[model samples]
Target: MSIKIKDFWKAGVVCICVLMLSSCDKWVNDTELPDNTIDESQLNSIAMLGRIEKGAYIPGPVIAGVWRAGATSAADLLVASGAISDEIVPTAVPNSPFYKELDEDKLTPDNTSLFSVWSNIQNYRARAEDAILNAGSLAPADEDGVKVKQAALVNARLHAGYAWMLLADYFSVTNTSHSIYADHKELSHQEAYGKAKAYWEQAIPTASDAEKRLLHSLLAKMGIHTGNYSLAVQYINQSFGASENFSFLNTVGTVSNGFFNALNVNSRDAAVDPTLVVALKTTADKARNPVVKAAKGHWSLTLLKERDPLVVSDYEEMQLIRAELIIRGLLTGNATDLVNSVVVKYDATGLSNFPAGPALTLNDIVSIRRIFLSWRGTRLIDLRRFNIDGDLIPGFTQRKWQWIGVPEIETQK
Candidate 1:
């Protein structure tokens, strides 16, 4: 694509947005940036693309902040693992039981969590769309620039579309046609899902090898959930060889250089401390704001890995896709495609575990997702989308949470 200087200036000015339901029209379009030296070539620069993509994951906590009540969203797993359950909000006083019950679906929406992850996803999607738009407006000419731009464009769309999908599937509400730029009309449940799939279709072709694999796996979710077995298989094939390893951070003992310390804006994400949890729970009666100081480390170690392996893209994801297609009656492809992917190719002696068969199951797929995504901020959407086993979430679904009781002030006894 040819890039006129004016177009380059425009691209740099307005940040991209992804939420179609509530699209953002940036003000920068009216006010140009002071540094107008961006070129189409920058899109391909690893240095450039890396910097831009960092924005996507960094600000995610802004949305998570609300989800965890007053605590950071980082507490998501810990809450789910059930460590901080008794760190009662002093406000939880008499109403806490009924209200808490309601929040967890043990009660109802009459008991809503502090925030709607469903709605927050829209904001996230809009942010992603903005990034894609930036990619589109780039006048990238170099080979590397082309690759990075295309990858950015595809991932940007993927993030936006997935956000919308999460919103529709998880929440009690559903409105997909809300707008890519502005509200057009309210879309039904299926319509919104279709919109998400359509967006995924358009963007999938442009993804990098790794991204393609990730999308391929994700497409299976959207398609299978919707009964489009064949479409799911096709997308899965498109994503072959995407990931081959999975790894986790080994940060607990090395706190000063750990992942928690790196991302903990509040300096509160320490390793699981049983004593701290009990201490905070007991002090609740004397506390002010009780939500922030409750459980310190119940779920933090749920699946804590000493060292996460880099699970790269492999044919295994494709095999599972094929298998699901067969189960759904959409494809006649040999199940070997699926079977071979999971067959261990190497043993302790480093020989092929060869010709493995039917070892994978639906449970296996879920396990893979958990290992792969870990605490990468992908679970909240899934948890909202009918919970772990495709069971409808009870109206009283209490999302994972953390409560840091507001510290007490000294008083003369």
Candidate 2:
């Protein structure tokens, strides 16, 4: 795969990383220093390790067409998954067949979107593992290099663990069927969460300030996925300052933030699912008012122009998590007040296009999350996690982890 960071690849420079071996023979051959092998001396140096780390992040598009997916291109996955829930609806249903399948919740094993997600996640996991294990083998030449190499390894492990969590949370697979490692081991959800937590724990002590903040945010997410709300709240508290929000960057040729291009530019899908407006209309709450405007018979989400950065974690999510904890009596606060504060803040700042209504509750919290996290992804997961799959919305379907379609590469096993 080629990575283009603002036309640098056009300058004839190739970014290459030693990804996990495809075969046991190749794995063994790596130790013998074959002709194609990365130089051992280079691998031992901190400079080369830094390059490998950057290579892992280069957005390599994976699933094409309707099921666009990539290693780093999670925004695409957001849009695709949004179709499965009542968060996003397709504009051209007849032309875009995947939208119909996603809308109806009829996913086959060979579904292109599922296959793309499965393949890309495994590759990412392998790449991260390669970096972590290889980096462990070398000692840095200087103290600064040692810190840099350690940070890279920490980030690599975090990425690998996250891939495992995504696989476990989003797909149903057996150890023998969906193995990504040479050993052919597939982890259960609990096992995946365990691995993710371990990686975060390993990185925390040595991580730099910014890296540590990211680790905390990710750990909080893992906690939410694993049904450990208390842990999630604890981690979110340590994540960052109340005002801080985090985003990952994307470039034009190298990384097209696929959410904007596919939906707005290509005109392939509708901006916002119309259900949010419909739900409020029927709720009979006089105080309820959300800020979705109709354009040409559909909601106009024209704010996110092309080239907008995607938020990785934000204060809205952190507070929502806390609000849920408060509602459950696990935390000490008025859940309504906490949720309304966030909602009012979003509306006051005009940061969120969706305006907050009066006298909010837990349901409002969920609604605000759907609005705030619209293309940020988490719609289907929230539905599944809350066990309200077929509720709330009229035609909602239960989204659950699915077994992967047999890939061509798996046949080699």
Candidate 3:
């Protein structure tokens, strides 16, 4: 059989078995499940487990109703968060009313956008949790295939932890209870952060070099938020030797990058803040500016073509974290040298026309960070952090978020 057919056949078989075994519900509806469901006994093979892992990264149809591929991944959530924070603006009404609400900072319980974000976040979390929970339960076909289980467990934990962190970061009202089979109660933001930290820490031991780097970056943010600058610094130091940029693969069948989709394909929304685009252009910051375009009076991003990769975390973020720590006196380093190092490095890496001779201020670190991490969804948090520290950007708008409580869908339990 062709690879496509083979993949389809395997996915179909796995879906049937998983649904029957896991108690299909709202996300994985039983009525829609394939009739040719396989028996649970057939899942012991390593090949079948590999198929399950592959399916975990595939966009929904298994869990969430919409098959957004990668759009609903981190970038999409970033879009929602950006929209809520004034980093993105609405030109036309979005399909999801919740996004409109987010743009207005007035989300309601019944908003579909809220449910979509909540459901997608919870669905990813459930899949990750399932992989971790089932890691030891499944019997490998071969006696010495222990590596497969460990790999799967580590991958699942990494995704689960990050998903949990995303939930804590974006969702005002958090839910720790996720699973189609059982109901879970809601968690406060602090409780949610605890869950995120636990999963991240659990995954760190067996994570690959690159995965460990990504986790360190995330844990740094966690530490900073929890007022443990020491822990944040330690995590950054451990993973600082190399630049590990975690990007969302925007291949065909996997969704396109969210920014490109929303601003270019959808055209309903664009970058609202002109100053952001202006800064990138004037400062010779080619890394962020060229991707921004203006047409018909709408400013949209063209960073990724159809399948261009979207960077989620990288060296730039690591440097910013280090810079922030230095500014706060958490890490022992000259803040100016650290910030200048970032400038010098970026200049060396194709920013030849970098405006020269300005000593790096703490605001410069934050501003450079803003330019480098633009459209990746870290803008709002950076603004918030800096604003809290009285390092306000001259023309930045501070968005106020009102938490939308747990939706009725989850409350049905």
Candidate 4:
């Protein structure tokens, strides 16, 4: 893989100054290191370690300036995933064949959009590893410094874990082979998830209370992805409380939220599926699926502002996971109440409940998730979980690609 040294410097310099305080003066003033190279030894202090961890979460040079670390990447993933699934339809305005190819289920290794997602995520994982290594090398002189070092290590592990989880979720095994390439080796989906699980487990010893919740939520997601309902419930029990409203967002600093910019500001690269639009006409549905008219005639999601943080995980997702487990008979609880809890929280009049009966099927849960979790970027995983075929809109057929293939750049290596 090739490294964009210029891109690294551009993002790194801004991130170092923005994320660190006066503690960065020594590192910034050092002129011995070449402008193009960042010496690992200089990243010795706890402050520098934190800076490196934060850098992993900011937008890197991918798709020019549009693609970012957390939410932006999540947004693009939603577009591709929604296009492939039933939640979104491609538009010609952006004139990017990538969206259209995804809509038609003709994913190729050369899809730049997928490459952007792959590269940015790999960058996040790599930088996170760098932070971990730097943390290990640091010898804190004070208790506060030790805490900072520990926090940086935990945060880095969380970022690295999520990177692997995303790789496992979004990319598929090609030619009945590897799903992704890392460290010059190919990793299958299960192998990737295993790596994610290990990282999260390692962080458990030093993670704070808030970080622990995030870890459990992530572990629950991994269980869901792997069809381990028992394991999902195990972690879900240890995750955020129902009313906590916990969320983990990837901070982009000065980078624009690429998903919002694409849909509303830059161009209408993708539009809301007509099926969802019609469903949103209902009062309760409208509340859950909040959207506004874009510059073009299509509807754009208003759930996130242009600079709003991209959600990594939240309590709503935890509730949905718990509800699914209840429906699956793996856990004991009123799945209806759990589902309605989300509906009531988002809907204005609280009339969106599913008629309070046993009639709720897995499909009902999936539909509710599709609307409530629309642009949050869970649709693709949901589609894979449900083995869904055909678009939500009537008469639209889904194509064969369940997971995006490895980008061409990686394959050539």
Candidate 5:
């Protein structure tokens, strides 16, 4: 919401053709608007539009359900039946309007309606990219202008990365239909994943320090897709080191801000918009909605529901990534000892310390991430990636789009 930039980067740039270039007069020998009059003071309307669009990007992550999901238990209607498929559950899904991350396995390309929300996500990403290109180029003597442009650029690029990440996660194999994406013909599984990775990497340099931290977090997500836990840890760690402002409430917008309205629908929202995951504890703390509330996955009913309590802290992600790397033998030090050190900082359970017994399992390290980064939308990516690769990660079931979840269910009416 708030933007900051260093001093030299402050000025906003603008340029206009001056009429006086044709004349050599001394007094009035300056720029002129049109034929006789030039409005040098007017702000560029295109830039103003770009500015507005840039600021609107803050909501991309939370609305799309990029945070953790407890199998769509939060929504009364979706999870009540207990099937928990993409059709009925995860209503706040990334590509779904009524669910979080629709089942893409059962999908078909010829049908237009089923593909709507997925298309919308892609649109959101395109819009953010466009806004960044338009306004991010502005430069002028105004110190505030520079900050605004830089912030806009970062916002657009970050959101772009977020959107692409969602698409990469959903299509275990990228969609090849001409109607699906920018190229019309979908890419190979590796190609789609690579595109997502490249976008996030490209964004690192232009993003602000705070944004760069977030970008690093997203980049680690890409690494996870490639099964590169070491690289994932590297990016996640950098995010923790650089970000001074990190919290669920602030890192993402629309946590409880009427984003749930879309849950009333039956189709996936869009592909390019990063997804969101929201929780409800119920008055009785029954855990009726999301179903799984284990130590790490659980939500506290006593705490406020409007903002994310499991708000992302770079430290939490760093610890988990480090633990994973250590478990994978990427980091040489004791994983058990390392896991112990990280978990304490994570929950601050006040236990004496983490046990220095034996090396840990993938689930053990993931549990640390699960407990610490709950509801922040990071889990979906994890589930979609490694789980798809045939790893036996817990609570992940692969569901692709089938006609039942989309227009087949809707267009019939």
Candidate 6:
């Protein structure tokens, strides 16, 4: 009986096929609906716009179950930059060839880890652009929708500006040619910075009050980086109040904090530089420089947690920028008082102000930034800016590289 039932089902399928063949023209004439597709028009919803905005910050699975570059690129930058500079040192560990490459300053264009960071930075910019476009295309029907659309556009622009700024800061330019994207078009470092400045300037009009202040701080930082001191001063005046202690952080979500995972949590691919540890031990700014010994007995920082936000810009950084300008004769102020103010706020209670003595040299500002801005992804730039090389600290080796080389993939035609 079971066999008979199977035969009956097979016969029924054959009959249906024969009937469809007999009416093939009619069947073919009937319209076929779209299968498993979503049109661009469908993405105009507020929820979709919010998601596009979030994508600007979060890493997407670019490599299909193999790697998530965008999520960890910033962390990679921190580790590589710190190891090359004086902030940290690489440890002997499994699956850490990239760390060794950066630590030894033997980077090649083929370095996949560094390439991932490069690609992800570009990805962030692309995603931000997408958010801006999508937000502009959307028409808000209510106040809530308007807020969401504006937030998406403003955040997108801010993040895009920062992405461009990072590219200009960390990557090298050769004879005014720096390949930035898959398209193989080359841009000089200054051109890259100019792009960042444009995005920031565009964002100011629609930004919320707090966001405006943040944008001003970012513009000031860009100005300082590009040697536009007058512009830096103008934005610094609008960025933060002296007592604000304001900081703009890239909030972590779904992705873990890169520095914590690399240096302290998952693997000890790097540890706080021994020189920094010794420096911290004698200094009263322990509050600002928290440290703990790793499993290998090397020091690691506790400045970040698994999901804590990464510092983007801050009041202290602005103050330091001003202090640098003062030392360079571009600004008028007591650089020591500016530096001392930060020291007093962060220094352990009852520690005297940054020794009131000789005028603060650029090197002194570098030293202060080395301590206060530890693990903030600025050390390498500082080293480059000050032309610091030939043994950063006692027993440390001479510096080998100034900026990370452009990834090989970008240079390919």
Best by TM-score: 4
Better of 1 and 2 by TM-score: 2
Best by lDDT: 4
Arrange candidates by lDDT, descending.
Answer: 4, 6, 3, 2, 5, 1
Tens-digit per-residue lDDT, 270-307, candidate 2:
54566654554322211222334444455545545566
Cα displacement (angstroms), candidate 6, residue 43, comes to 3.0
Residues 1-413 of candidate 3 have per-residue lDDT tens digits of: 11133233335446644543454343322453354444444443343334334424222222221112223557658777666554566665445465566656556767665666666666566556655655657666653345566566666666767776776666653223322211255566667777778888888887767668778877887776556677797798866444567666665344677777766733655554455555665334654545445555656765667677767677766767787787777777765555555555546654433344654466776676667766777766665555542222223344345233445566554
Q: lDDT by residue for model 5 over 249-346, one digit each (tens)?
A: 32232334112232222224311111112322222112212232223222212222434332333554555666677677776566666555544543
Model 2 steric clash pairs: none
TM-score of each: 0.47, 0.73, 0.75, 0.84, 0.55, 0.78
**Cα lDDT tens digits for candidate 4, 227-317:** 8777798889889765454333445455555456555533657766666787664566787667677666777766566666555567888
Query: Residue by residue across 1-413, what tens digits does model 6's lDDT show?
Result: 11132233233323333332343333223234333222333333455444223333221111110112234555556656777777777775637667666667777778777767776666555555555676788788876667677766777677667767777777773313543442345677777888888988898998867778889988887787676888898888788665443223334235676677667734657777777777664345567778887676777778777776555557888888889989989889989888877777765463646767889998888788888877777877777666666245422234445667777666655
Residue 310 CA displacement from its true place in model 4, Å: 1.2
Model 2 residue 343 CA deviation (Å) reads 2.2
Error of 2 at 33 (Å): 17
lDDT of model 1, residue 50: 29
* TM-score for predicted model 4 compared with the true structure: 0.84
lDDT of candidate 6? Answer: 0.64
Worst 10 residues of 1 by lDDT: 404-413
lDDT of each: 0.38, 0.54, 0.57, 0.66, 0.41, 0.64
Q: What are the clash counts of all predictions, listed in order?
A: 50, 0, 1, 2, 61, 0
